[model samples]
Target: MTSQKLSIINISYKNDESVRVLTAVLSKWFSNPKTLHFTSPNLKYPFNINHWISTFYNEDNIETYILKDENWIIGHISVKIDENKNLAHLFHLFIDNENRQKGYAKKLIRYVEKHIIAGKDNIKAINLNCVKKNIPAITLYQSIGFQILKEKKWLKMIKYIDKK
Candidate 1:
């Protein structure tokens, strides 16, 4: 099978429609209690756009990204950079259910690594957390050089990019 080309677009308030669609996609997937608990433990069921906006959009340092293949947005991720700590934290990474196992997640991750983590000289590492039961995500992160920080209910992983 041929690979699809993907682009990561930084989400903004102007892209209201895109965010709404993304929210819909998220709501659909998170309807499963297990999926919802894994991705967003604090979030309530039946994900709403208003709550999503209030949770993710209000922070200045956190930037949401949409992964698009051609004109279709098939994935989403959010990054929050801590300049003081020289760290970037990845949160709420999701690929549309219909589009999984297609390398979209890897492309999105590499985009973040190149443009966000490695692009900034001071950034020391990128960190993310996943449910321990989520083996696919753990495997993907490991393949991309992330190592488990410690064993816990939520597995924390880090990929260090700064050589200095």
Candidate 2:
């Protein structure tokens, strides 16, 4: 747990200013492929600001949460809900290095899980694809009862949500 206090708030797509702020923070945090990268298009930071802007403006299922510490923004989590599959997938989960090792990540996960449970009637799983190389993430997910069902070369590993 970190000494710094933080709060998570849901953001609407209409808020461009907040999105831009998040983009700036994420761009800095995800500047290296070693830390994070686009798994689909396979791109690295500085990720195209225009592309992110378009995503923020157009994606209907997208929901962003801002983690704020007093007046400063520390991190955010982006979730995309797939109603067809009844799944809420975590697309972007980034915490500023300085604010990490706190309970923020777990809190964010719990927040999103609650949102999923409340918003969708039959959501079965909350899925996320993490690089196999990210040991910390793997450990964290496992700690949260996420089991690795399948694995691809540094790519895909599916975890079925354990609805308890």
Candidate 3:
């Protein structure tokens, strides 16, 4: 990644062909056993399209963003804000096979923090969960200021942000 700006778009508001394409690609990516084990999203590998579609559009507080390297789709991530709890939960962060190790993951995460979730009302901490065995992901998260919050069944991490 360079100093060049990356392109990101919110795709959670639609239920169209584009979303259909998104679901297919997401399914293919998750279908890989390694990817499935690392990310550990709620949906099963090769998830039902209708269910994923409904989950995507009907979630009121969550917004999913697609990160692009110019015209190519590099990755996608979602953020869910809990107003009453003053926190935001990050999930479903992934980079495509060819885009890994290029600093795009950090770029995507920071873009969401600064552009999407930071100014939201009273959102004090951003949190996420990942498998302990996923060392690369864990290291990346730690490098970007996410500290381990727990080490139980699933590794949980958090970073507190200043709105001011």
Candidate 4:
């Protein structure tokens, strides 16, 4: 994930009317009950959009990046870096179903590593919460150098950052 071909596209948060578009895209990604229900562990049912936005965007930790083709938003990835715990958590990572296997996730993650973590001076590790049911994500994370620091019914993954 750290080194991939997605560097060509810019990764950034959306604003203005883009938020509405991003929200629609998020709704679409969550349209599948199976995908949405099991994406995060310990999430209470009836996920609230206001709460989701508040948690990330209100405090400025949540980041939403669109993969655009000229002017259309093809996909997006959201991340939240918790300074309190020194954890850069991946909140939502999804590519448009039509745009999968193009290494979008890999590139976005690499962008996070370089600009988000490497740009900071005191980050300890990147941590994210994933449902135990998400084996595909678990496998991908493992392949991308993440290890299970702790595992309950869910997973808390951490990838330590170089401090020096």
Q: How many clashing residue pairs appear in each of the predictions shown?
A: 0, 0, 0, 0
> For residues 49-143, could you state the per-residue lDDT of candidate 2 as single tens digits?
56765654477888878788876777677788888988777766777787777767777887888765556767777777777777877777778
Candidate 1 residue-wise lDDT, 97-161, digit = tens: 88999887888888887787776788888999898889999999999999999887789899988
lDDT of each: 0.81, 0.69, 0.81, 0.67
**Which segments of candidate 3 are over 4 A away from where they belong?**
1-5, 53-57
What are the candidates' C-alpha RMSDs? 2.3, 2.9, 2.6, 4.3
lDDT of 4 by residue, 77-127 (tens): 666777887777876766667766776667777777887678777678888
Kindly provide the TM-score of model 1 when superposed on the true structure, using C-alpha atoms.
0.87
Scored by Cα lDDT, where does model 4 land?
0.67
TM-score of each: 0.87, 0.82, 0.87, 0.78
Clash list (residue pairs), candidate 4: none
**Cα distance off (Å), candidate 4, residue 2:** 23
User: Candidate 3 lDDT, tens digit per residue, 40-62?
Assistant: 55656656667665654577888
